[model samples]
Target: MSKVLSKEFLQRWAPLIVLFSLCIIVSIINPNFLSVRNFARLATSSAAPLMLAIGVTFIIIMGSIDLSMEGVMAFCGASLAVVMLQFNSFVEWGFLAIPVAIVFGVAIGFVNGLIHVKLKIPSFLVSLGIGFSCIGLTMVMTGGVRVSASDKAFRLLLTERFFGFPLMVYVAFAALLLAYFIQKKTALGRNLYAIGGGEELAHASGVKVERVRIIAFALAGAFYALGAMFAVAQIGSVASNLGTGFMFVSITSVVVGGTALMGGIGGVWQTLVGVLIVAVISNGMVLVGLPTYIQEGVLGVLVILAVALATNRKAIQLVK
Candidate 1:
């Protein structure tokens, strides 16, 4: 009975409970932590990581990892600023820049999927190579200079608030909703879990594992593109390192949200809670006056704890 209860607790309530505990601690340390203003700021800050987490959620669910988002995001940010209405821009596509950037990212995703699925390359190696290549491309594009695209309209996409929250928050919310829809309502989503849980069995059952895997990476790419746009909107500029820290933060969000690194056991809602936890921790640390350097330690400990709790139920004889 104790074992059963603990398993249920870990699976059904651990992430939420951890999130609430963090909220309570932060609110106690800084009474103003619960204020609407701070929450709005938190929402804005979390927008980019949320999208990245959502994108990778499907990939992780399919028992694969893609480390190329950081590169993809940086490349897309450059593309958006260069093509959109901006200072020093080569074109003035205005709103069209967003979709164009997204498509560029999708193309990259398709390549990643193809190499991994068809060539049988490890997803990890493929994504890492792609990410490095993208970073190189970004540096070449800008010649080591940051591009500032202070387009008022683009800024408005992030600055304009409705119901006390920025439009960027709504955009992130929409992304979450769409991710949930995909997870629950689509065959692609279903195949992802099947693949993760048991790829050989899923393939034997006619799940078309390769096709599903490719599409999963493609979806992840599309989300990475959107995340790049939001990142630029939040800063009003595009830098070669605009995606500098996304890989760690997004992975941390996915892990802290109770998603297994081993895959097949989590969904978008878990990732959303994870994103909020990360945002709050990042913001709350400042409010409570924790030293900047110690924060990484805190996050690392939390991630370890989350992973330990999640994978504790079963033991593996071998790990690659």
Candidate 2:
């Protein structure tokens, strides 16, 4: 009984515990890890991943997974750059590019959800197919070349700082707040949890499971669009590879933050902790002189450990 209780406690608090523990361990190794400057940098680095994780959190809570982030992000980033370039800057009418990018993402996500729900296809497979298609479309649009969106006004997201952190961090925080609201205060959010708990039961309870799933996916795409904007801002350019590596980072952060891949067990707040945890580990590893390969290995191990502790194995008899 004691052992079971301990496991439950750990599962409930693992993300927070892991975050604080990583902070302490890294600070001990390199005191600079605790410095305000380093923290600011970490916040900047974490902003994009946080947005991506937040977007995916909704889908995950619905017991579905989205592997379309990389392709979606890249396509959106490229689209933003191309659209902004048409007007030469983010001033006046050029600002329209932002919404255009977000709407594009929403459409893509809507279609993805529609196919998944209507065609009886698996979520992961459907998303993966759409992701690849998006990537191919992006490549065609850009002619296999990088598009530059270095407009000074738009780049302010990364260049300009207020209160010791970049504006992008604040934007990410705002996104987080909105996502939290949708997840907690809205009917859709409640329905998501209901579906995740058990889809058939949710449908039997009169919940419009299919509609909620579509909306959740569309909302996630909007967040991914925001992530793409931040990613472009951080680099001042866009390419087919603009979203490279985000898949590993965002999903890892989401899971590490304690949102179970099996779903119905986490939130955006947890995703925030997970993003910070990943940022700290990556930054700390660099500060301590660890090679890239080792950092990757450490992250993989951390994900496995987090899932092990967070998963209620007894509740899930079939591995699937």
Candidate 3:
């Protein structure tokens, strides 16, 4: 029993320990990596990707996947830029465009869930198809042109600083808080764990598995919309490829933060740690003059290791 408890403790705390270790190692290699200014930069750079990771956390926790983030983010980001342009600036009613974009995301997510459950399609394939469709639609909407949301008010998310961190960081924190609440304090959160642990068992226990799954996906979409807005705020530009690199970052952060790919484990806090870990690694590599390709390769290896650590291999006989 003591051995079991020790194993559990280590599994629960390993991600955090790794995170601290990475910080120390990087700070040692390049002391400037520990500076307040660099920390602020890390937080700023992580804000949008953190939102994306938070969104996918729900889906992954429910034993499902969401590859649609890139497409959803691309669509929403482009839409936000167009709305801001139409209103001349976010200082006008363009601010309303934020919620509107999120609503669009919610609708798309709802449909993605509907198709996944009602049509008996696997979530990954369903989400991937929807994402492709969204990307195509986004290209058509913008006529393959890059849209800019250079409004001073909107860009303030990046430009305005409070307590040495940009406002976007705070916004991402708020979103994180909201996700934590949902995961820990709500019936939906409970149901998500139930389904991920064992869908048939959850359904047997009268958990309304399908409904919970759909709700989880919709919730994820809302966060994706926020990610889209944040991305535009960070760069002041939105193109069809705005979400190009997010899929890898968000998924990788989730898994590396200690979330199991087979689901039924991990939460938003782990995701936050995971995002910070990735951010630290990326920043540290740059500070240490490591190539981008090396950074990507390192992240890939980390993902594989994380998956192996998080999986219960003894109970699994199949590799699917």
Candidate 4:
């Protein structure tokens, strides 16, 4: 009985153990990696990706993927930048811009959901097409140019720190908490799990599968928009290419957090830990003087390994 219990414990907690060990190893290699300033910087730098990962976690929970993340983020950033720069002339609007950006995000997500549900198309293709369309739209709006950060208040929201933590970190924590609530306390959350487990079964069980999926996609879009806003705030500018490569990075974080790719499992808290692991590896690589170009390759390998360890292959069967 003790041996059986030990095995279960290791299976459940192995990822966290590995992540903590890596942190310790990296810090030992470079003491600066453990400094307070670096810890703060890491939290700030990871905020956007963490938001993105949490958003994607919902979509994955429904056995679907949202590749429109990069496009959604780019659109949000571009729109926000244009509003605060070209339209408002850097005037402070007292947080009104944030809600407006969030609304735009939901609208984009709704459209994406409509396309998927109405056309009966696979999410992958629908999201890819929508993402491309958003990119084209952004290009047309910005004329392929960068938008400078002009809003003092918006900039402060990104740069300011409270109690030694960046404002963005607080925002991220709030978002994470909201996600946790939705996944745990809401009926919609339970429906998501059911759909992920078996869509037809969920529909037969009166889960309102379509509505839940649409809402999930919409919520993900909102999160992506928030992430984009944070990105622009952090960098003080917006470019057409601002969200490039985010799709894979966000998905990687989710998978690393022990969320099953086959779906019907995992939660936002797992995503939080996964985001930290990815952030630590990336930050540590830089601190250890690894070449920037090699980072992607390293991440790719780690992603495969993590998936292999976390996935329950016996529960899932494949034709191939």
Off by over 4 Å in 1: 1-4, 86-92
Candidate 3 whole-model C-alpha lDDT, 0 to 1: 0.91
lDDT per residue, candidate 3, 230-294, as tens digits?
Answer: 99998889899999988889999999998888889999999999999999999988998988667
Query: After superposing candidate 3, which stretches have Cα over 4 Å from the reference?
Result: 1-5
Q: Pick the candidate with the highest TM-score.
A: 3
Cα lDDT of candidate 1 equals 0.88
Question: Each candidate's lDDT (Cα)?
Answer: 0.88, 0.90, 0.91, 0.85
RMSD of 4: 1.9
Q: TM-score per candidate, in order? A: 0.95, 0.96, 0.97, 0.94
Better of 2 and 4 by TM-score: 2
Please state the error at residue 196 of candidate 4 in Å: 1.1
C-alpha lDDT (0 to 100) for residue 135 of candidate 3: 99
Give the top-scoring candidate (lDDT): 3
What pairs collide in candidate 4?
none
Candidate 4: tens digits of C-alpha lDDT, residues 1-320: 78756845765676688789989989999999988899898999888998889888999988888889888888888888877764554454635567777888889888888889888998988999989888888888789999887577777766688877889899889999999999999998998899999999999989887889899999998899889988988998888888887887898989888787778888898888888898888889888988767767877997899778766678767723
Query: Tens digits of per-residue lDDT for model 2 on 224-293?
Result: 9999999999999999988878877888899898888887779999999999999998998888888756
lDDT order of candidates, best first?
3, 2, 1, 4
Span of 10 residues, lowest total lDDT, candidate 2: 3-12
**Window of ten residues with lowest summed lDDT in model 1:** 85-94
Give per-residue CA lDDT, model 1, range 60-157, as digits (tens): 98879999999999999999988884433333457788888999889999999999999999999999999999999998987889888788778887
Model 4 alpha-carbon drift over 4 Å, by segment:
1-8, 86-91
For candidate 2, report its TM-score.
0.96
